[model samples]
Structures are given as C-alpha cells and as structure tokens.
Target: MRNVLEAKNINKYFKKPVLFHVLKDISFEIKRGEFASIMGKSGSGKSTLLYILSTMDTDYKGDLYLNEEHVTGKPSVELSQLRNKHIGFVFQFHYLLLEFSVLENVMLPAKKLAQLSHEEIEHNAMQKLKMLHIDHLAKKRANRISGGEKQRVAIARALINNPSILMGDEPTGNLDSYNAKNVFDIFKQLKEEAGLSLLVVTHDEDFASKTDRIIQMEDGHIIHR
Candidate 1:
C-alpha cells in the first residue's frame, strides 16, 4: 500500500517563560485507506502534532511529506492550496454556519475550490450528505439541528471537496456514546469505500481501539504504534 503521510524527526519547541520542547523526534507514516487514532493525555502534545500535520503549522524542525510530496516549509499560499485539495478537517466543535442551511455549509468548500459548477457542487454536496445518512436534514438551518446532527453535517462538509485524507480532532467528543458510535461507523465506511486515509486525535479508548491502529503518545513522544 502507498503511504499518504510521513513525518521524519519532527521536533517542536516553545520559548515563553522558559524554553520547552513540545514534540521530540516524532515520526510516523499513515497508509492509504487506514483509520488511525493518535491518543494521549491533555498535555501530551497530540493536538500540536495534528495541527502540524494539517499543514497549518510549519515552524517545527522536521520534514513532512504528504502524498509523497515534501511539504516542509512550503509557503503559506501553497500550503493553503494543498490543504484544500488533499485534506479535510473535522473538529470537536462542528463549526457550521448556523445561519446557513446544512446543504449550503457542505457546499462551501467545493464552491471555494471552484473546480465544479454550481449544479455539480450542489449534487456532490447532496451525495455526501446522503452517504452520511443526513440528506434529510440538508435543507434545515444548521443551528436548528442537534449536536449529533451538527457533527454529522460537519463530516459531510469535510467530504464535499473529496479530500484524500480525512482528519478529525476529537470528532466524537461532543456526541453521546450512541451518536459517537454512529459517527465513527460513517468514518469507517469512508475509509473502506473511498480509500481515504483517516487520522483522528481522540481520547476515547473504545473508539480508538476500533480503528486500524492506535499511535499512542506520551511526553511529546510516540510511545507505541
């Protein structure tokens, strides 16, 4: 299988009151179609690592590669373009536009990419909503929905651009056990059917164990893979 992301000797530091090393020589590879989780305590720097992987944080001392392209230290504009094309993000809080209808929120990324016409973008947005079993809520205002529904809608929006890798930062954190499982099942399907790589930063052990692999971290270092 092909590797979708690779990190080599990644190191991140902070210099405020005192110099500190947040990440130390972190390295890992995620293969295509894999559903993997990064697990650690609150101070373990898991979120920091995920942020760097998202291509939005490039101040670390290491090499980062996505889709076999060396993306370390790339310019902001290039990283922005790369992120739009190859990455999709879901946060603990589903950051949907409350005033907009669910369909509109999902279509925003596709519209920004502008690779498709209005009609095509609409169709693809609906397709993603249906795939997540949220098509029935497509026309409803985002704020009118429940938390679980909002998170599902966020996932749908993330998929609208057909990103190669689907990333989640505590995607199920806001949902109850039932709804959390519901969202995770859809994630598994996305990995299985579309061959998309999934990298999730989460604290739920039950959820993490079900994924293909769990990369455990402690004290800013990977403890297990």
Candidate 2:
C-alpha cells in the first residue's frame, strides 16, 4: 500500500530557562487506509508527535511527507489549509461547543471548507452523525449529551471534511471501559467502512492491539514496535 504519511528524523525541543528535547530523531510511516497506534505512558511525547504530524505544531526539526508532498517549514497559513483539508483530529476531550447543537458542531469544519452549501453541509453532517450512531442527538446541545455521545459527536465533526487521515490523542481516555470499547469499535468500523487511515495515541495495551500496527514510545523516543 502507498504511504499516506511519513516522518523522517523528527526532533522536537522546548526552550524555557533551559532546553528540553521532547522527541529525539523519531520516524514512522503510515500507509493509506491502515489503522495504527502509538502507545506510551504519560509524558512520552505521543501527543507532540501527533500534533506535528497533523500540522498543528511545526516548530520542529525533521521532514514530514503527507500524500507524497514534503511539509516541513511551510507557512502557517499553508499548513492550516492542508490540515483542514486532509487531516482530522480527535483529542482526549471532545472539545465540542457547548452552545452548539451536535449537528452544528459537525458542520463547523465543512463551513470552513467553503465548498458546500449550507443545506449540503447539514445533510453531510447528518449522514456522518448517523454513521456514528449519534443522529438521534443531532438536535441536542453538545453539553447535554453523555460523554460517549459527545465523543462520537467529536468523531463525526472530525469526519465532516472527509479527511485522508484521522489522528487521535487518547480518544477514549475519559470514558469508562464499556464506553472506551465502544469508541474503539467505532474506530474499527470507520476503518472497515471508510478505509480511513488512523493513527491513535493510546496507553491501553488491549486498545493498541486492536490496530493493525503498534509503535511504542518511551521518554520522547520511539523505543520499539
């Protein structure tokens, strides 16, 4: 399979009173339509790696290739556009707007794309929400839903633009075992149904095992896979 994303010799450092290196020469490749996991303990730099891959943070040393295009040191505006069009993110928190209805939250990214009419965006949002089994909550305020529903809404929002890659940071961290399992199942379904490329950061061994491949991180470095 062709690679959808690749990282070469990635190194990230944080500077304060002193310098702290968070990632040291990290590298990996994700194939199109593959489900993969990055597993690590707290402070292992998994989130940082995901942010770099998603173009959320670019002040790092390395090369990133997305869909065969080199993406290091690109202007923020360009990076933002690329991210919006090709990448989707799901954080540990749902990060939904409490004031917005579930459908509205899902429509937010489509609105930014500026390619779809309002009606078209709404129709697409409803379809994605239905795919996640959250269509019944589309009219409800995000804050009024259960944690599981909120996370599913977030997933729907992420898929609104039909991104080529889905990057998740501890997506099930806040849920109970049952809900976490459900969320993982949803990811599995996404891979099977949509052929979505997924790279999830996780601490759970069982959850990581569910993916096609697993990369293990330790102290800001990829130790093994």
Candidate 3:
C-alpha cells in the first residue's frame, strides 16, 4: 500500500527554562486506508509527533512527507494549502462557530479552499452531513446541538475537502462510552467505506486496542509499533 504520511529521523527540542529534547529520531508511516492509533502517557511526545506530522509544527528537524510529497521546510502558505487539500483533523473540542448553522460550519473549509463554486460546496457539505447521519441537524445553530451531534458535525467539516488522511487528537476524549463508540464506528465506516487513512492520538485503552495498529510511546521515543 502507498503511504499517506511518513516521518523520518524527526527530532524536536524545547529551549525554554532548559533545553530539552521532546522527540528523538521519531519515524513512522501510515499507509493508505490504514487505521492507526498512538498511545502514550502525558509528556510521551505523541501529540508533539502528531503536530509535526500534520505539518503545523515545522521547527522539528527531520523529513516529513504527505502523499509521497516531501513537506518539510516548505513555506507556510504552501504547507497550509497542502493541509487543506490532504489532511482532515478532529480534536477533543469541536471548535465550531457556535453562531453559524451546522451546514455553514461544514462549508467553511471548502469556502476557504475556493476550489468549488458556492452551489457545489453547499452540495458537498450536505453530502458529508448525510454520510455522518447528521443531515437533519444541518440547519440548526451549532451551539444548539448535543455534544455527540457537534462532534459529528465537526467530522463532516473535516471531510469537506476529501482529505487523503484523517488525523485526530483525542477525538473521543470528551465523550461518554456510548458516544465514543459511535465516533469509533463512524471512523471504522470511513476507513472501510471511504478508504480513508486514519491516525488518532487516544488515551482510551479500549479505543486504542480496536485500531489496526497501536504505536506506543515513552519518554519521546516509540516503544512499540
């Protein structure tokens, strides 16, 4: 299978109070259509590694690639563009614009991309909502929805641009077991039905165990893969 994301010899340092190495020669790859989870205790550098892989943290030393294209050291504007086009993100918080309608929140990314017309973007937004079984909530104000609904809407927004990989930072962290399972099922469906690659950072042992692979980290190094 082709790699959707790869990191090679990644090293990160923090120069605050004292110079500290946060990541040490981290390297891994997520293949197309694979579902992988990163598991670690606090300070393990799992989140830090993810940020670097997501192309948002560029201060680390190493090589990073997305869809076989080298992305390290690229200009911010170009990296932003690549992120919009290739990656989908879900975080612990929904971060939706509460005042806007659900449809509008999902449409925002595509609108910023501007590669599609208004009508086309709107149509795609609805399709994503429907796929996530949240179509009925499309016209509701984002703040009016329940927590699970809000997270599903966030997932819809993430899928707006048809990203090649979906990255999550404790996406199920804020949910109850039932809702977390719902989110996990949705992710499984996306992997099986949509053939999307997934990389999730999770604390839930049950959540991590169900993924295809679990990458365990400790003290800024990968202990198991």
Best by lDDT: 3
How high is the CA lDDT of each candidate model? 0.94, 0.92, 0.96
| TM-score, cand. 2 vs. native | 0.97
The CA lDDT at 52 in model 2 is 91
lDDT of 2 by residue, 133-175 (tens): 8899999999899998999999999999999999999999998
RMSD of each: 0.8, 1.0, 0.5
- How do all models score by TM-score? 0.98, 0.97, 0.99
Q: Cα miss at 84, model 2 (Å)?
A: 0.9
lDDT of 3 by residue, 1-225 (tens): 899999999999999999999999888999999999999999999889989999999999999999999999999999999999899999999999999999999999999999999999999999999999999999999999999999999999999999999999999999999999999999999999999999999999999999999999999999898
Off by over 4 Å in 2: none
* Comparing 2 and 3 on lDDT, the stronger one: 3
- Name the runs in model 1 displaced over 4 angstroms: none
Q: Over all chains combined, what TM-score does candidate 3 have?
A: 0.99
**Lowest summed lDDT window (length 10), candidate 1:** 155-164
Leading candidate by TM-score: 3
